[model samples]
Target: MSSKSLQARYEAAFMPNYGVPPTVLVSGEGCVVRDADGESYLDLIGGIAVTSLGHGHRGLTAAIAEQAGSIAHTSNLFVNEPEIELAEELLSLLGGDARVFLSNSGTEANECALKMAIKFGKQHGRTYFVAAENGFHGRSMGALSLTGKAAIREPFGPFAADVRFVPFGDAEALRAAVGPECAAVFLEPTQGEGGVVPAPEGYFKAVREICTDAGALLVLDEIQSAIGRSGAWFAHQLEDIRPDILTLAKGLGGGLPIGACVGFGSAATIFAKGDHGSTFGGNPVSAAAALCVLKTIASDGLLGHARTLGEQWAAELAAVGHPLLLGVRGRGLWIGLVLDGAHAGAVQEAAKAAGFLVNAVQPDVVRLAPPLIITAEQARSFTAALPGILDSASPQE
Candidate 1:
């Protein structure tokens, strides 16, 4: 079908939340996607950082197929094999003796963490929560309450009371905000949705100590940074600090939907019988896909690939010396091209027109989170094409 026809169908059937982009994607291979119009584009955003292994990964498909054929879903009532196995693998990767609560998406995982924190805090007569400003958690009620973006939260106000926002990357501000009255400190090691910003040096370690001293749980929202996206299993690992609660999703299941709220130490023992539940949270098919994603990332040595390739791409893009470019930030496959001008949206549209996919995460920040399987050559192609893309998007002065 034509892109216009498919768009018309989509408009007729779906809500107008996401205004339809020009192209309607049909299929994908590796890091490239083909639109309905038979044009291929390097999908650098990778389904907004969800497709870790890129499109049509055989191992992911096979795992999903095998698990679905065997047992697609068995509610939270009965334990399933894939869920158990995936939990074990995730705990092992985290390098901690942690318990996992499976859910359906990043927001759900964060919601689980929030509930856990609230329950845990209530025990100690605490109720307030601390989160970083500009931090993006999910759109769910509880998660949105924890999110620090005012514009996103204001529209859906009457959010949970007693939630506080501290400036991100400011250790002193975080220290001041987290106190005995604080239930938990929810933060992202790197602010992914806030323009791919990583925490300053020693920031997380400082926050960890602050939360510890305040008797508050430190919850790291790694939905966009975990599962090898940041060239590491988790972004906080770079600092070697362990969080009381860690929320994950996005690339965890590659393209499948799966989320996990992992609790460690005392936090793991907080939730008891009748505490919380999700019917199709850890369905076998999604669990199987998640397991395959983790295994494939390790076996294929994608972590090292992400680190090296990401560093090279950033350096190369910086070397381009574009007049409108500021610099680059982020680690591994997750990157942000900082623009000197407010032309990120125009640049994103221009890149799309030139057969590339990127995200204008902020007014002046372009987020690039390609698949972990993306080749160095493919990355270079995008970087090489970026200068012209920017030039085309610049104001015709």
Candidate 2:
């Protein structure tokens, strides 16, 4: 079917949670995707940062196929080799003696982490949660309750009580909010949906100290910053501060669906048998795909590549010196191009017309999360075209 007809069909049949994009992508190779009209585009957002190795990665496909052929799934009732292997590999990369609880998405990982924190809190007679203002967690009840965006959370309330939000990047506010009554303090290493804002220097160190002093668990939501998206295995690793609980997803499974909540030290044993379980949490196929993603990243040195290219890409874009380009936020392939005016939606459309897929995450912030496998040539092509794209968009004065 043609792109227009497919979109019409989609609107007619599916829910309106996500408005339809102009293109109906049919296939992809590496960082490029072809729409139903056979037009190709460089996917700069990389399926919202989930397609780590990009489309049609041979190693990932092979791992999925091999695992599916042998053992595609195993219920939590039985053991699975791929699951075990992936867990061990993840813990090793995390540099912790941690236990992993596998799930299917970032929200699920966060949910699992919440459960651990609540359980741990109950044992200590604490019942409060401390999160950051403008932080986005997940849509699920518990996760949403912890999310500080009031517009989204207000409609969903009466949410779970005892959750407080402090201004993000404000160490004093965070210190005041977290204390003996708090069960856990959840914060993202970098705020992805909140316009790709990074934590200020030594902010995490202060948070760690506060959580430690308060005897509350520190849950780092690394969903968007983990799995080599930030040039580190986990973004928190760069700070050298260990969170009691860490949630990961997005690039974790390359393109397949998988997420995990890793618990360290005492938090590792917080969940007892049957405390929380999933029917297909750690299916062999997804586990295999994750394993392959890790292997390819290590062997290809994609982490260093992402870091170097991200720096170069940011510098090139800045050097373009476009009037509409205000500044850049974030690190690695995860970037937010801050525009001088409220024209991000128009810029996104213009970029799409110019054979590029970027996300206007906020009114003036364009998010770019290209695949880890993206070449310098591919990135440069977008950077070279960015000025024209902005001109076409016509930002307000």
Candidate 3:
């Protein structure tokens, strides 16, 4: 069917929440996808960084298929092998004495972490929360309350949590905001939705120290920066600091859906017999998929690959020296190409026309969270075409 026809059908059937999509993607393989019109484009954003193994990867598909063929769902009432294995693997990567709560999405993982913090803090007479400005936890009500962005968060107001917001990347501001009454401090090691911004050097370490001093929990949301995206197993580990709680999703299950909330130290035992649970929290299919992703990332050495590509791409993009370009920030595969003006939209459209998919995360910033398996030739193609794309998107003086 034509993209226009499918779009018309979509408008008639679905809610207007996401607005109109530019194209109707039919299929994908490796780092490329095809629209309904049968045209191909390099899939750079990797399904908002969800497709860690790229599209239709053999290992991921086989694992999902193998598990689905044998068994899929097993409610929390029963135990499953993959579920146990996946949790064990996550804890292993964390290198801590921790417990994990599995769920379906990043938001759910954050919700679980919030509940853990709340329960633990209430016992100690601490009920307040501290978060970073421009930080985005999730869209659900509880997670939304901790999110500092006003535009997407304010509309769904009257939230229950008493959260305080401070300027992101400022350790002193965070220290001033956090107090003994604070249950926990929620922050992202890298703020993905806030334009692929990385935490300032030593910022996480300072926060860890502050949280420890105030006897509060430190929760780091690594949903968008984990699973080899940050050139490390976990972004916060770059600073050699361990948080009380860590939430992960996005790339954890490759292309399948899975989320994890890992609690360490006192936070691990916060949940009682039945504080919270999920019907599909640890489906065998998703757990198996996650196992495959973790194994493949390590077996293939994608962590070092991502680290090298990130450095090379950042340096190359900066060297392009285009007039419309401002600078670059972020770590590993997650890079934000800053623009000289609020022209990221125009640039994104121009890039689409040139057979590359990208995200205009902000008016003046283009975010790139390509798959860890992205090849060198595929990356250079975009860098080679970026000058022309910028020229096409640049305004006439």
Model 3 accuracy (lDDT, Cα): 0.92
How does each model score on lDDT? 0.92, 0.92, 0.92
Q: Listing every candidate in turn, what is its Cα RMSD in Å to the true structure after a full C-alpha superposition?
A: 0.8, 1.1, 0.8
- Report the C-alpha lDDT of model 2 over 1-397, residue by residue, as the tens digit: 9999999999999889888867799999999999999999999998888999999998888889989999888889899999999999998898767899999999999999998988988899998999998899899998998898888889979976578999899999999988788999999999998999999999999999999999999999999999889988889988989999999999999988899999999999999988999999999999999999999999999999989998999888888778889998788989999998788999999999999999999899999999999999999999999999989998445
Model 2 local distance difference test score: 0.92
Model 1 poorest 10 in a row by lDDT? 14-23
Score candidate 3 by TM-score against the native.
0.99
The regions of model 3 sitting more than 4 angstroms off are none
The positional error of residue 100 in candidate 1, measured at the CA in angstroms, is 0.5
Error of 1 at 383 (Å): 1.3
Taking all chains together, the TM-score of candidate 1 against the true structure is 0.99
Error of 1 at 222 (Å): 0.3
Candidate 2 accuracy as TM-score: 0.98
Count of residue pairs whose backbone atoms collide, per candidate: 0, 0, 0
